[model samples]
Target: MKEFALIAELTRSLPKNDTVVVGSGDDCAVLDLGLPDQFVLFKTDAVVEGMHFLTECEPEKIGRKALARCLSDIAAMGGAASSALVTIALPKKFDVEFVKRIYTGLNEIAAAHGLAIVGGETTTNPERVLISISLLGLVDKKKCILRSGAKVNDAIFVSGELGGSLAGRHLEFEPRLAEARWLAQNFQIHSMIDLSDGLASDLRHILHASKVGADILASAIPISRAAKLQARAESSSKPPLLSALTDGEDFELLFTVNTKDAVPLLDGWKKEFPKTKLSCIGKIIAGHSLKLHDKGGVRELSAKGYEHFA
Candidate 1:
């Protein structure tokens, strides 16, 4: 089955559980902790051989990416990471030193982030290497951001640049957990999501949840320097804007806040995250579709970034 179809089917088949504060369709599943101000955010992600990484790629980097991807989900919720557990599937003919390096990479990052690697299962696959990490985090119930809170006229913003992940940023990108937390504490962020699936596709998730549309200005879209350089080199007809629109795996944060507070947030962001880039590319609308404001015209957004099915 296609990725999204399988996701929908599973979401429907799963029995509703009352303990889930925010369930399927979000970056993380928030569980009720029965505390007035706290919620638990849970996420798990995997990196597989030949798909997520080259079979010849360093095993250590592969292990690091597996854990980082799951941690990105926690950052999307503006949560404080707590701990992690890992599952590994290795080929029967694997070398011991190679496995040790993989864990070495994973342990290094985990220690830096204070994410304790508690326990996990390992098995022999005899075909491909597969590493999965389950991450637990804590969020303030009052401050936790979800994709469903966007309101009409809310300003949309994205952190850092987008596109050209294939140029190598994807493997070494840092999760914006610190920035997300700072934003939640300082600004009234209405809704937030990590830009793992590109702006066009991921923004749709916010629209679906908030029952709102967005009007994105083509000129205002933030194009990463890497994407611009790549576009120039490719000499392809696709514009840099297209790259910024469709390139997934950026791992940046896309969020929305009230128009009134947008100015202050932007003003404070400079002093707070001096090296990070932030852009206001759009505004939420009352409808249920995305419209792009191109030069002298408007058009509906097209199939974007990477989707497993399409």
Candidate 2:
């Protein structure tokens, strides 16, 4: 079965309470926690040796990627990360220096983000290394963005360029925490998500949650230089456009706002983040089918990002 299908089945009957404002199916599980002005954001992410990183990959980068994944989810909610607990499962014959180097990377990012490393556990996996990070964040009650908020005619936007993450961008990509917070504070962001699973798959998540669809202009998507280079360098590689649609781990912020707010949002972003590129690529529509508009007119978008156990 596919990863999403398995998740749906497993979470179908999970226990819940009144405090659970937003649970499963979102970038983060939000809890009302009785805070006067803030909601708590909870997220957990895991990285494996052979899957997320190569065995020869630097341990420091590997650790950074593990924590960065959870941070990106928190950013999707327009929240500030607070603390995290890390659990590492290693083989019986693990290297002490490698584990210490991993912590070096993890600590550096955590400190930079003002997030504390609380506590966690160490276990034996008997095979490859597996690291899981459970992160906590907080967002103002009124500023928290969710996937279910997209509306008809809302403009969809994405931060940074997309695709070619496997060429080293994935491990070094920074979480869009500052950008997301700025967007939520300056504009009425309707919905948002981080692009970890590619534009096609991640955008579908917002549409499904909002009970809507989107019409994306193929020409408007900002493809990365790395993606273009990869396509030209290898005959067997996917085309740049397709790579932009399906390459996972972009880690950029994808969001929506009122159509009227589009121009102002773009102008403001240009001034606030001169180094980053934000693109207005599409618009939300009233429907259930995701469509791509290009020189060929319109067609249903059947291509999707990578999924586990598909």
Candidate 3:
């Protein structure tokens, strides 16, 4: 079973909040303040030693990734990150210098994004290292984008390339803060999300929330050469392109805009930020399932984003 299905099945329903602008399925949960000018956004993400990091990976990178993962959610909401709280569960064998280096990495990224580390907790764990970060951000209430706002005829867009994040893309990916800011200031984005999970799975969140479907063109997905190389290095039977489709942790932005407004906005985006390539991969439709069209012909796509207990 896919991740979302399990979440819907196992998790009990909670009282819905009218203040929630975007909740549960997107990158961050946004709360409305009722003030015409401002809204608040919150997000939480956790990193586990065995699941999210390699045993020998640099302590600094691990720390940076743990924090950056949450910041990416703020970027998705077009919000300015304000403060963060970090909770760490340290294993028995952890050293002082290791912890210090990890804090250094986290602080570096936080400073770069103008976010302050306000408070947190430290705990002891016998088995593995775990880090959880929660972030608070602010946005304009009228301007906040949501996953449920997508229209049937909107054009789907993705920032940067996709796939093979396991080959170091996850470690070094820059959060799309500048790009998201530009998008918020200049364009009318209908909905937005960060592609932490695979594109198929993440896109499904928007579709399901909006009660729509999508027709994605496989040929249009932008793939990095690094992703192709990694796929070739890891497998011989299946095309590396499949890895690009299935591999998660590409922290790029995936958003949608009205079909009429997409072309001009895309042209401006290209002229402004050439490094972050933008690609139009699909269109929203009036249905309940996702379809992918490729050389292999049309097929139903599965929503298989990364899940903790999968």
Candidate 4:
């Protein structure tokens, strides 16, 4: 069964409400709350021990990563983090101090992000560790952005470098909150998505939602330093470009701006975020497939990123 196809088939008939500003398909669901100018954003994400991390990973880092995952969802919608509820499932044989350390790390990050752990639940798992966080956020309706807003001829830009998440970058990555806020405030961003599943896979989410295609100039993508170093060390004959396309977990902002605003946004970006690298990788086209351009000429961009049930 084709994974994405199956997902589309199953969800095609799901019920929906008029109050749902943005529903299950996007990073976070935005719902009308009867507020004059705001919509509520809700998201839930989970990280498991074996899949997302090694069993020996520090409990504190795991806690931080769990919270960061949910916060990234908020960032995608250009919203403000409000509060969260965390549910933890611990192995039967775990130390109390170790658990406390996890909470301590999580609490610190929550406080820093202005999130309150209003409620949660705890349970025992057979031998694995699982942590899930459900977060609530607020976004001004007029200012909110979603994956379905892209238009043909829009310029595509991605914030920071991509790929090489396995080289400790996945655990230490910072969500692009400040960068997203700035983009929303200054630019007429049409669509946005966080790169959690690599550019090749995640870009399709935007294309499908927007009913548009993209033509990416492969030479323009900013591959990560870690990805380049890893390619050199492995000597596997694979290019760092492949990693940038499929490595996933980069958490950078992949957004589109009006073609007219692209020049100004890139120009002003240099002065405001001198440290961050922004690249114009592509343009949104009036179709529903992803195409990549290189010296070899143009071809379809494959969707090979992580998918659980593919």
Question: In order, what is each prediction's RMSD in angstroms?
Answer: 3.0, 2.9, 3.6, 3.3
Which regions in candidate 1 have their CA more than 4 angstroms from the true location? 305-310
| Candidate 3: pairs in clash | none
Q: Is candidate 1 or candidate 2 better by lDDT?
A: 2
Per-candidate TM-score against the hidden true structure: 0.94, 0.97, 0.92, 0.94
Q: What is the Cα-based lDDT of residue 38 in candidate 2?
A: 100
- As a whole number from 0 to 100, the lDDT of residue 217 in candidate 2 is 91
Q: Model 4 Cα RMSD, Å?
A: 3.3
Off by over 4 Å in 3: 9-12, 15-22, 34-36, 304-310
Q: Residue by residue across 1-310, what tens digits does model 1's lDDT show?
A: 1787889987886776789887888999999978778999989888888878876767777777788888888989989889998999999898888888889889877887888999999998979988989889999988899999999999999999888887878788888988999999988899999988788888998998999999998889889888888888997645677788888889999999999999999999999999999999999999997988876578788546322211
- Candidate 4 per-residue C-alpha lDDT over 29-132 given as tens digits, one digit per residue, 9 for 90 to 100: 99997989899999999999898877687878888888988888889999889999999999889889878877887898888888899989999999888998
TM-score of 2: 0.97
Best by lDDT: 2
Q: Model-by-model lDDT, in order?
A: 0.86, 0.93, 0.84, 0.87
User: Could you give candidate 2's per-residue lDDT for residues 72-93 as a string of tens digits?
Assistant: 9999999999999999999999
- 1 against 4, candidate with superior lDDT: 4
How does residue 252 of candidate 3 score in lDDT? 90
Compute the lDDT of residue 298 as modeled in candidate 1. 80
